[model samples]
Target chain A: MLKVSVISPERTLFDGDATQVVAPAYDGEVGILTGHAPMMALLGRGTLRVTEAGGERRFTVEGGFLQVVDDHVRVVTEKAATS
Target chain B: MAKGRELKGRIKSVEGTRKITRTMEMVATSKLKRAQDRVVAARPYATSLAQVIADLYTPELAERFPLLRQPAATGPSGGRAAVLLLTSNRGLAGAFNSNLIREARSLIERLERSGAAVDVHVVGRKGIGYFRYTGRPLATQRTDIGDRPTAEHASELVQDVMRDFIARRLDAVYVVYAKFNSAISTPPVSEMVLPVTPPERKGPARDYILLPSAEAILSELLPLYVRNAVYRALVETVAGEQGARRTAMKNATDNAGDMLNILRRTYNRARQAQITQEIAEIVGGAEALKG
Candidate 1:
């Protein structure tokens, strides 16, 4: 499991452990599993999908940054809403 | 006695005043709760933004970003500074508006003394009126934004300030407002917002994949961060204003109630004195007639 936190300028959308996560980076889509390397990517306007124990959740995020360090991922965006 | 009648009238007037103040106190209390909720709602955004900045910031990159670089103090005297003052629309909120205005005025004066031309921008009716009455020039007077300030309003202000800053028309931007602490807030404070301060590194640096490049991402992020900062300031000021108003109205109501109580006691004493004099006269007249 990977600890993931999705935050928007208005509020926090999600913060929990997830099995897998996929986000739209500036160049293309990137996916993360449990042991992803520490890296930073610029986010473009697209849907961010996170797979938890229950099901996959999607959020539309725009113009932000995503960071992965020590199996923890943090996504910060200007505007985000559940898609 | 005539004094008794006068005291009765005073008590009635005090009662009316107390009713008005009590209602105001209740209204302020409700407003304060709403403002507090807004402050809470606004917190996550700011916290997240700061976290992202911290996570990505590098000392070398901080120097490259124009917004993160501090303005030179030894620059030419023709440089301009913008001051945005947040106040309330209405009065009777104790020193809420006045204190902010006074603090802003002093800041403006100080900026002028330092050879920077100051442009005052005011939000809310109270600030507009005070600046206008004092013959202080205003670059913008925005009274349309109501008690509940939205992110859009903050963005609008941000656009103008950023445009000026980018064009080198303004050297620095400052915000004057009451910092919200709780139900009670601190005195109005002047905070410099422009030439954004680079996030200090608090934790060990963990490398992240920079898309496009680090510079590209920072270029996009800095403006949004500034806008968020402005939005937080506005929300904080709104909460503080409500708090101040609530405290002021409560004091007014309590004082009025105390005055009414004192006046009622005085009226009762005067009535008793008059009644005692009438009984004494009756007893003395009866005794004289019997003799």
Candidate 2:
């Protein structure tokens, strides 16, 4: 499982354990799984889906970045709302 | 009788004032709590942005991005600066707006003394009114940002300044606002926001795969950093405004309570004196009639 955190300037939208995550990068969409190589990408405006144990959570995010390191994923966006 | 009545009226008025002040104090307290929470909520995004910048920043990258580089020369007549002053919309907050305006004035003066041409951009109604009253030229006057400042508001506030800085029309950008240290201590401070100061790197550089390119990422991050800085200042100013208003209202309420006590005591004393005078007059008339 990957520890995922979705943060916006207003609040933290989501933070928990996730099995898979997909984000809309500036150039394209990027997917992350556990033990993925460390990476950083600028986020575009689109939906970000995180698959947790209970269910799948989704957030509409815009204009920020995503970082992954040691199975820890951080999504910081300028604007984000749970959708 | 008239004196007693007058005192009673004064006491009633003070009591009403006390009630209003008390209500305002309570409102300010709740608003302050929410503002403080917003400040806390914004931290995660700020920290992550700083971390990403720290990881990606290099001396070589600074050379390519004008935002990361200091102005080459700031000699007299060579430097251009902009000061963004953040104040509150209303006037009830005691010394909150004044403190920010004072700090901004001094910062502008310092910049002028250094021979930098300073452009003033003001936010909030109080600051705009102050600049207009002083006949100081303002490049922009924005009054729309209220108690709640979002990232969009922040971007709007700083976009022009950032653009000018990049175009080499401005050498530096400073933001003057109240820094919320605690409930009791929120001091006005002036902070330089640009040209962007790269955060100190935290650890050995990791070879993370950079998507798109490092230059492209840095370019995007620089503006985000400025917007975040402005956003933080906006929230802190709001929190400080609420704190200041709460303290001011609390003091006003306490003063009104004291005044009410004094007025009540005076009214009672005057009433007793009037009763004593009326009895003396009646007894004197009865004694004269018996004689």
Candidate 3:
């Protein structure tokens, strides 16, 4: 499993080992998993879905950035909304 | 006796007001400290990015980028101009919202008079409210930017404004915000952003090298710069509001205290007079009884 993290300015929204992660990127949604190529992407306003070790956590984020490297997916968003 | 009663009422009202203002004063002070500290901490990261951009500058890369192009003053262009107007999310911070609104109105008027169309990018709720109410056109709005801000925050705003600039959706971009000087003073300032010109500085040159190309580094760093600048302004604005609120609350509390002091004196005088009159009445009654 890859390590997936979604962080907001005020607090860390989600941090766990994930099988796959999908986020709203600059243009559209991007999916990342273990052994994915390194990429830097811009994020937009939308939901972030992470399939974790045992459960999946979903977050709605508006604005910010995403960095995917070496089985580590990190998301930094301006604000996060959870349903 | 009547005077004492009136003074007592006045004192009680003043005391109540004092309590309220005192609480406000304390709240503002704590917020101000937090804002000031946050701004101070974010400086290194902002300035460091700036320094990197400065280092990235080269005579070769300077020639290629349209963003590096400079516009001469005193000319009206049919091209687009984007304005980044920063206002507070909430009010009660003395003239913070109005000052920016006034300036924005005047600029829009000037742009219209010059036959230039403008696109405004708003940063806070106040600006949003004003522009929406005034029926002005806004390119975008980033609302609810509160006490703490980060580079990530700046990046998003930068993306829109920068894209517009690059796409020629905007010919120029201007940032209007309060330049915080100290706890007591802050002034609204407008700066031209976009076209990534050589920063106007009266300092000595330093040695540096370009990481990729000057253009590449600049393009990469420019957004960060824009973001940091916005974040800085936001933090400063928050801090300034806190300072102003603190001052306003403190003044209110002090005035209430003064009023209470005056009322207390009057109340004491009235009570003493009433006591004296009662004593006289008792003595007169005793004399009559003796006689």
Candidate 3 lDDT over B85-189, as tens digits, reads 888787767677788778877777776677778888898888899888978767788775776666566666777777776666677777787777888887777
Q: Can you write out model 1's per-residue Cα lDDT over B1-291, one digit (the tens) per residue? A: 789889988998999998998898899899989988888877866776676677777778877776776677437566899999998888899999989999999999998998888999999999999988989889998988778787778899879988888877888999998899898864799988898886566677667667777788778888888888888888888888889988999999999988888888889989999999999999999999999
In candidate 3, how many Å is residue B117 off? Answer: 2.3
TM-score of the second chain, each candidate in turn, equals: 0.95, 0.95, 0.83
Q: What's the TM for model 1?
A: 0.92
Identify the candidate with maximal TM-score: 2
User: How would the candidate models be sorted by lDDT, starting from the highest?
Assistant: 2, 1, 3
RMSD of 2: 1.6
Candidate 2 off by > 4 Å: none
Q: Which stretches in model 1 have alpha-carbon errors above 4 Å? A: B73-76, B288-291
Worst 10 residues of 3 chain A by lDDT: A5-14
List pairs with backbone clashes in candidate 2.
none
Model 2 error, position B175 (Å)? 0.4
Which docking class does model 2 fall in? high
